[model samples]
Structure formats: C-alpha cells, structure tokens
Target chain A: MICNFGAGPCILPQEVFKQASQAVLNFNDTGLSILEISHRAPEFEAVVDETIKLVKELLNVPEGYSVLLLQGGASTQFSMVPMNLLAEGQSAAYLDSGAWASKALKEAKLFGEVKVVASSKESNYTFIPKDYEIPADAAYFHYTSNNTIFGTELFETPKTSVPVVCDMSSDIFSREINVSDFGIIYAGAQKNMGPAGVTLVIIKDELLGKSGRKLPSMLDYKIHADNKSLYNTPPVFSIYVSMLNLQWLKSKGGVAAIEQENIAKAAALYEEIDRNPLFKSPCAVEDRSRMNICFVMENKELEKPFLKLAEERGMVGIKGHRSVGGFRASIYNALPITAIHSLIDVMQEFAETVK
Target chain B: MICNFGAGPCILPQEVFKQASQAVLNFNDTGLSILEISHRAPEFEAVVDETIKLVKELLNVPEGYSVLLLQGGASTQFSMVPMNLLAEGQSAAYLDSGAWASKALKEAKLFGEVKVVASSKESNYTFIPKDYEIPADAAYFHYTSNNTIFGTELFETPKTSVPVVCDMSSDIFSREINVSDFGIIYAGAQKNMGPAGVTLVIIKDELLGKSGRKLPSMLDYKIHADNKSLYNTPPVFSIYVSMLNLQWLKSKGGVAAIEQENIAKAAALYEEIDRNPLFKSPCAVEDRSRMNICFVMENKELEKPFLKLAEERGMVGIKGHRSVGGFRASIYNALPITAIHSLIDVMQEFAETVK
Candidate 1:
C-alpha cells in the first residue's frame, strides 16, 4: 500500500474509501449510484444532517455556533471571510504566519483596511509570530492556525478581544478546539476532513450580521447559515464522502482520540529526524506542525535519490511543497503510526546508503 | 432497473459510475484513490487538462474562450457573474425567464443597476417572455437558458448587441449551441455535465476586465482562467467524473447525437400528455423544454393518485417542482430513451385505471 502524504487533498481512512467507492456504485443499496441522487432527496438530507451532527459532536461545538458544509476551498473562504465580516474602511488585524495567512490578508485588504499585527514572512515562516497585540478597533482578528507550506502551527488560540476568525485548513479535527472561543473557524475539507470540494465553517451565530454590508447571497454567511448550507444545490457527492469520512472519525473515537495518535506520530518522526544525522527539520521546534512534518537532508544532493527510494519503497506523496522543497510527511488523523515508522526506516536506510 | 429522473444531481451513465468507483479505489493504477491525490499532482493536472479539452471539443467552443472547472454550484456563479462583470452605476440587461434567472438578477442588482428587460413572473414563469427590448447601453445581457423548475427553455440565444451571459445549468450538454455567441456560459455540473460539486464555466477572453471593479480572487474569472482553473484546489473527483461522463458521451456521439435523442424523448412525452384525457402540459408549447417535461392532471384530485401510481410503477422523480405543482420527467443526456417509453407505458396504465 502506498502511503499518501501529499499536502491538501491528502489521505483518508482506507475504510472510508471503500465505502465511498461502494456508494459511487450503489449507495446503501438504494439501486442508484450516489452520484445520481438529488441533493434534496430525503436520503441525502439525512447524510447532511448526520454529517453536521458528527461535526458538532467531534468538535464539542457550542449552542450558538453553526457548522456549515460549503463548497470551494479555503481559498474561497479567504474571500468570503472578509466579505461577510469586514466592510470598506473597517480594519481587521491579521497574523501573517505563512503563505495562506498572507493570502487571506491580501484579500482582506481589498475589502477593508488590514492591520498586520505580526508576520514571519521574512524568515520564510519558520515560526509562528506570537508577540503581538490585536487592535481593539479592528473589525476582527484573522490568522491561519496551521501553515501547511511552512510546516508550523499555532496550537493555542491567539489572545484577542475582537471576534477571532481562523483558517484551519490543514490541522482541524486533529486536536480538540473550544468552539465557543472563536467567531468563525473554517477549513477546506481536504486535509483532515475528506476531499477538495467542500469547506467546513463553524461560526458563532450572534457575532454575525454586524458587518452591515449588502453582501451577495452566496457570500453572505448569514444566508448560508440561515438556509442551513442549503442556500443552493450543495456539493452532493463531496458532502456524502465527507459524511462517510466523518463517520470513520467518530468510530475511531473522534477528535480527542485522534489527537493522541497524531501526537505520537509526530513525536516518532521528529525524534527520528533529530537522531538521524543526515536529516534536520528547518522549522522552529516549538511551532512544527503535527499534521505536516517538513524536513530536509543535511547533504542537499541526496534529496532526489531519497525521494526515489521512498517512492520505490511504496511511499507516495511524500514530496514537500513547491515553496519549501524538501520532504513533508503529513501524519494526519488517518495516517497509521506504522507508516511513520516506515518513513523513519527509509531515512535511516538513506543515511546508510550515503555514508 | 430504477430510472433516475430526479432534477439536479440526477442520472449519469452506469458506465461512468463503474469507472468512477474504480478510480475511487485506484486512479489509473496510481495506487491512490482519486480523492487522495493532490490537485497539484501532475496526474491530476492531466485530468484537468483533458477535461477542458473534452469540454471544448464537445461544445465546439471557439478560440478566445477559457473553460474552467471550478467548485461551488451555479449559485456561486450567480454571485461571481455580477461581481466580475458588473460595477456600481453601470447597467446590465437581464431576461427574467425563471426562478434561477431572477436569482442571477438579484445578485447582479447588488453589484450594479440591473435592467430586467422582460419577465413572466405574473404567470409563474409558465412561458419564456419574448418581444422584450434589449437595452443597447447596458454592459451585458444575462439570462438562464433553461428553467428546470418551470419547464421552459430559451433554445435560441436572445437577440442582443451587448455581450451575453448565460446560466445553462440544467440543459448544458443536452444540445448543441454556438459557444462564440456568449460572453460567458456557466453551468452547475449536477445536471447534464456530471454531478454536483464542480461548475463548468466558458468565458470570452476579451469581455472581462471591463467591469473595472475590484473582485476577490475567487470571484475574478481572469484569475481562474489565467491559472487554468488551478487558482486553488478544484473539485478533483467531480471533474474526474465529468471527464469520464464526457468520454461516455463521446463514445455515444457528442451533444448533437444526444440532442436528437432528447428531441425524440420530449416529443414522445408531450404527444402523450396532449392526447391523454387525464394529463396535459402547463408550459407554453413554444417554450417547452426538451429536458424536464412538465405535465399536470386535468382532474386536480387525480394528481396525488397519478403520482403514487407513477412511483409504484417505477417512474421515479416524476413529481414536478414545488412551485409548478405537477409531474416533471427530466430526461437528461444520460437518461436512456427506453426510460421514456417506460414512463409513457406507466401513464397509459394509470389512465386506463382512472377511466
């Protein structure tokens, strides 16, 4: 079996794939492929309902928060987040820890004034910027909780008074998060969730409608929330697969349970990187992402051969991002710890071959 | 076997589903489920390229147009069409043909002054309004080519000097059209194209950038076109399935061949509706859609029993839209002509019982 580790649109549980593929053939013995079913069918409505309930149960979402299963990716959310929350001349503070964070702020600037509280761009986002104060006058505080490209994460919520909005595209559902602490939390359903078509947005209901902007119905979160994410024909198959994946997550004991496994997986790999003399992690120790582990070879010329070896040995999608070329093994909720050990074994084997 | 006549996210070819399920298990023998493959992967990029190529070939899309496979449904396009093409103080003409047409106009009004040249709203959109004047000074003319709910279709492009935009969601690939005649053509893939999740957008390269309005990157067609639909992560599986479905269509001959089948199917159903004492069509005969044949009972009380009999006799999704209150038989490209015969048989059987 190939170990899939390529960034977003990454691996899901094998069982989920089995179920998804089966649904494509025949969904729940309904005599119809899941692809051919209408979004408004009672069966599909149940899928949407169950998926939402699973999200609430897994995240420990509070009473006032609305969990939305939307389409487009986190990139679309970068635009929608500000469109619904910030109007012209109103300022929103941003923490530019990585490429995605900066992308979010850039879009925010087009809609409103953006205050850059802190950014690690100069260091190529090697660490998350921590020592910054959020302006009270800002409309909201926005940050990318985990930087997939930079391989760093902000484990704790930033201290802020303004409504906190996060783009947790890569690392959501890997650990426990207090749903009530933020005004909005959105993640593309590609890394830890399921595939690349849908986006999961958890919003604190009361904090909405204050932007007072005449938003297009699709861009207005209130409309989507009010319509229960059925404002239009949703991404039906993607949502269905997501529901299957989320069901797998719940069966594996939900977020709190997966957090333990993620921690162990990260620790094993990070320890291997530190111990193996030929390899080193470029990211700052404290901020290294639990989801994506980015590391580089001490002897840079050996990198291509290492990738080839990994691929030959049944390792798939271990190539690092384009911006930061090295190797990134994303040990998400579904990646087995045994695969982590296998990656370590490859590293040791590579070191031996080079030495 | 069950026939899927359910509106959007309706029927796709059985062969496409088998291939899709196989890809979900192992895509092109890559040992990775299509769902897990990165959008940036070379193989996935090839899928995107080939899908665009097929779309161009099937639609006879001329030069100076970009075909983008993106996410969200036609609802997202309802916003993006106005956001990218319309600016404040500028006026755009709209033909309010149906509910979706009005929804598109609603979004356009938020972006600019929308001049609805004509509407049949007073008659519940039972017919496509004609004899409306096109405002030459308007920036563009927008209309929904097919009304899935009201069972009307504008087969001919509206005679307009201004650039034309169309939402061809329900009947996009069912028939042939001159792609060069419009400034933009978009469709949610759930109908004739593939499944829900991805949208097919064909944009005239020159008509963009005239809006002179700042658009969020996701809303900007140029950005998506320039990036070749890789501005961000696309709906990988949806696009893959679309490519598969399009290949199946090509195998059976292109849209022109399907159009012949569609015409035959619609003609059969409409002929029966007119001849039967129990049933009659509510839509204007001139404006009747080749897709989604809508009919109602002459005796209002027989409606429930007729629908129940149709369902019992394996005629699924014949219940009309909520707004129209009748029976609709959506015979999209994938729906076989034999299914049409089966439905006619059911109608005849039900008629005999009622008499």
Candidate 2:
C-alpha cells in the first residue's frame, strides 16, 4: 500500500477508516446510511455529545471551556476570531511566523486593527519569531501553533496577559498542552483528527459575548455554545468520523501516549536528513515541525528524479508546498513509524544511486 | 431497511451510499481514503469540478451564473446574502412564510433594513402568501421556496423588479425551475442533493461585489466563485458525496425525470390524506410542497398510535417538526415511490382500524 503524506487531509488510522466506511453504509444498525440520517435524530445528537466529551477529556479541557464542532475550517476561524472578539476600535495582536499566520493577520485586519507583534517573513518563514511583546490592550493575542507550509512549529504557548487565541490546525492533539492557558483553540479536523469538513473549537466560556458588534448567528460563538453546537444542521458525517477517530486515539492511550510515538518518528527522519550528505534541512532546527518534516537535495537537479523514484516506490504526497519547493513528508498521527523508516530507506537508496 | 422522511439530512440513493462507503476506505483505487486526500490533489479537484458541472447541467444554469459548494450551510448564507448584496441603509424585501425565513430575516436585519412585505404567520404558516407587492427600490427580494417546518411551497418564481434571491434548502433539485429568473438560488445539500455540511449556491455573477461593506473572506461570495470554491480547504467529504448523489441523479435522467417521480409520490400520500375521513392536511392544497407532505388525524390521540405503527413497520423520521405539531413525511428525490406506497398503506390500515 502507498503511504500518504499530504499536509492537511493527511492521514487517519486504518481502523477509524474501517468504522467510518461501515458508518457511511449502516450507522449503529439503524438500517440507515449515516449520510441519509437527520442531524436532529438522537443518533447524531449522541455523536456530537460524545465527540465533545472525548475532545475535552483527551485535551484535559477545564470545566470553564466549551468544546464546539464548527464548519468553514480554520480559514473561516481567522475572520471569526476578530469578528467575535475585537470590537470596532479595538486591536488584536498577531504573530506572523508563516503563510497561515500572515493570512490570519490579513483577515483579522478587515474586522479591526491588527497589531503584528513579530514576523519571520524576511527569512522566508524558515523560523518562528521569539520573545515578541504581545500588546496587553489588544482584544487577544493570536498565533498559529504549527506552520504547515514552512514546516515550523511553536513548541510552547505564548505568555500574554490578554486572552490568547490559537489556530492549532496541524499540531493539535499530536502533543499534550495546558488547555487552560488559551482563551480559544480551534483546529480543522483534516490533520490528526478525522476529515476535511468539521473544525474543533474549544473556547473559554467567559471569553464569549465580549464583542460588542452585532454578529450573524453562524458567526457568533455564543449562539453555538448556548445551543451546544445544535443551532443548525452540523456536518454530521464529518463529526461522526471525528468521534470515531477520537475513540481510536483513546483506545491507543490518548494524547500523551501519541506524543511519545510522534517524537520518535520525527527523530528518526531528522537523523537521516542530518546524516545523508545528499540532503539538507531548510527549516530552523529549533522550530522544525514533527508533523511536517521538510528537506531539500544538495543538487537541485536530483529533486525531480527523487520524487519520481519515491512515487514508483509507492510513496504519495511527498511534494512540498509550492512556495517552499523541495519535499515535505507530513507524518501525521496515523502515519505509522514504519512509514517514516520506509521513507528514510528510499532516501538512502536514492543517495547511493546518485553517489 | 427503514425509510428516512424527516427532512434534510434526509434520504440519499442506496447506490450513492454504497459508493460513498467504499470511498471512505479507498477512493478510486488510490490506496487512500477520500478523506485523507488533499484538496489540491487531482482526485479531489476532479470531484469538485465534476460536481459543479453536473449541477449546472442538471439545473440548466445560465452562462452568467456561478455554482459554489460552500460550508456553514444556508444559515450562514442568510447573513452572507445581505452582507454581499445590501449596502448600508439599503432595504431588502422578505417573504416571512415560515421559521427558516424568519431566522433569515433576523440575520439580515443585523446587516441592513429588512422590509417584510408578506407573512403567513397569522395562519400558522400553513400557506404561502399570494400576489404580494415587491418593493421596487429594494436591494433584493428574498424568500424561501419551501418551508420544511410549515410544509408550504411557492409554486412559481416571484416576479419582482428587484433581483430575486431564494433559499431552496428543502425542495431544491426535487423539481425543475427557470434558473434565469432568479439572481441567486441557495440550498443546503441535505434534502435532494447529498448530505449535511455543504451548501449549493448558484449566483448570477453580476449580483456580487455590490455590498460595498468589507466582508470576511468566507462570507464573500465573489471570492469563493472566483477561486472556484477552492479559496480554502473545503468540506471535501460532503462535496464528494454531493457529487456522487448528483451523478446518481443524472443516471436517473436528471431533475425533470426525478420531478415527475416526486409528483407521483406526493400525490399518492396526499390522496390518502384527503380521501381518509379521519385525516387532514394543514397546508393549502395549491401551496403544499411535493417534498415535505404534512398531515394530521381528527383525533389527536391517534397521532401517537399511528406514528408507532409507522415506526414498527420499518419507517423512520416521519415525526413532524416540533413547531408544526403533527406529522410530516418528507419525500425528497432519493425517497422511493415504494416507501410512499408503504406510508399510504399504513394510513389506510390505521383509518380502517380507528373507524
């Protein structure tokens, strides 16, 4: 079987896919396809409720925070964050470390003043900016926990007096964190969770209803929280798959256990990149993402041949982002450690042939 | 197998569900689940493009119109319609026929002045208002083509000097329409199309970029259309299922053929509701929807026993909306004629027993 390493919409556990496939045809022996069932049905209600419970339990989300399954992905959340939190004259501090971070800052500027605290754009976003001063007067401090395009990740949560909001689209659930530190943490479920439809939003209940501007029902977090994410017809199938994925994660000993495996997987590939004379790592070692391990060949001409060889060897989606053209092996949670070793073996075989 | 009739996330073709279930495991023999594939990948791009093409071809959408598969369902479109079309101080006329229309109006009021020219709330929204005057100076005239909660439908497109915008969430694709007559037609793809999560928006290209107010990236229709709904990571699974459903629709001779079957199915149930002395239909005969058929028994006590009888016989989701307080059998495109016949048989048997 080919190994998939595409960034978002990356990979999921095989067992989860089996259960999800079965659910699509016959959900819980109700003799109805999950695709055809009503969102208001008790079966779907149980799915939503159980998903929220598992997410909270896995992340250790405190009592004051509410877990929500929303649509429109993290891209929509960029605008929603400022729309629901920043008032007319207010400003929100943002860290522009990568492509997604810059995009979020751009969207936030449309709603209100966006105070960019720091940026690594001059270095083509190969590293994360550190020791940035977050404005206490701002509505909130916004940051992306992982930079998918540039293969950089913020290992620690930013310390700020103002409420901290995060777009943890890639790295969420791959590692354990203190959920109480942030006002809101939103992640698109494409990576490490389930599929490319639902978004997981964990918000501190007190942080809601603070934006004075009138908001649409769908855009307002309070309405969703109040109704318990049932204010409208949710993405039922996506949520069901997410619940299944979370169940699988729990069965494999939750986030803490997964984090250890992720570290080992990353270390193996990074070691090969450092040792192999034909390849080099572009991202700063300190901020290198465990999820997306990016590398480049010493001779640029080898890139095309390397990709073809990898493809022929049953490797897929190893092509890097267009802006940073080389290779990105996105080893998400479901990507077995053996897959990483297989990629390394390919890299070694290719290097020997070139030598 | 139980037949689903409650409203959207409603019934889909059995063939579509089978293909969808297989896709959840391996999409097109690519050794990857459709959920795990990238939106930018050829596999998913093909899915999105083919779905749009099928929609345009099936509906006979004119050249100047653009079709988009969007997230947040029709609820977000309630705000997006005004935010994209109505400028500050501008008024848009609305037909307040049912619960969803009122919710749309409530959201529109937040954007600008809403002139509700007609409403059927006085009669419990059991019939569509006729011959209502459309305000000539309004930005656009908005209405719901079918009310799922109240089981009423507009038989013809409302003629207006202002641009016509419709929420065809419940009854879209169940029948053919003059697509050129409306400036925009939006539907949540739960009823006749596919599943919950994605919304189908067919907008006249010229109607966009006129609101003058800054819009969030996700809420801006122009951006989505220009990007071909690839502006962000879309609800990939929902769109894929929608594509499969549309393919199924095409295989069964498109919307015109399905419309004929829909009429027959609705007639069979409605004929039983009218012929039986113990039963009655709440909606006006002329305005009654072919998609969602509502009925009530003379003795309210019979409602419980009839529903139990229907459920025991492998029928599901026939319970009426809580607001309407009776029974609703929503027969969307995928609901078979046999299911409707079974419902009719149940109705006749119940009438004989009670009489």
Off by over 4 Å in 2: none
Candidate 1: C-alpha RMSD to true structure equals 1.0
lDDT of 1 by residue, A266-334 (tens): 999999999999889999999999998999888888899999999988888788887888899988888
**Model 2 C-alpha lDDT per residue in residues A234-309, reported as the tens digit of each score:** 9999999999999999999999999999999999999999999988889999999999988988898999999999
Error of 2 at A159 (Å): 1.0
**DockQ of predictions, in order shown:** 0.88, 0.89
The TM-score, computed over Cα atoms with residue i paired to residue i, of candidate 1 is 0.99
Error of 2 at A317 (Å): 0.7
Off by over 4 Å in 1: none
Clashing pairs for predicted structure model 2, backbone only: none
Relative to the true structure, candidate 2 reaches a TM of 0.99
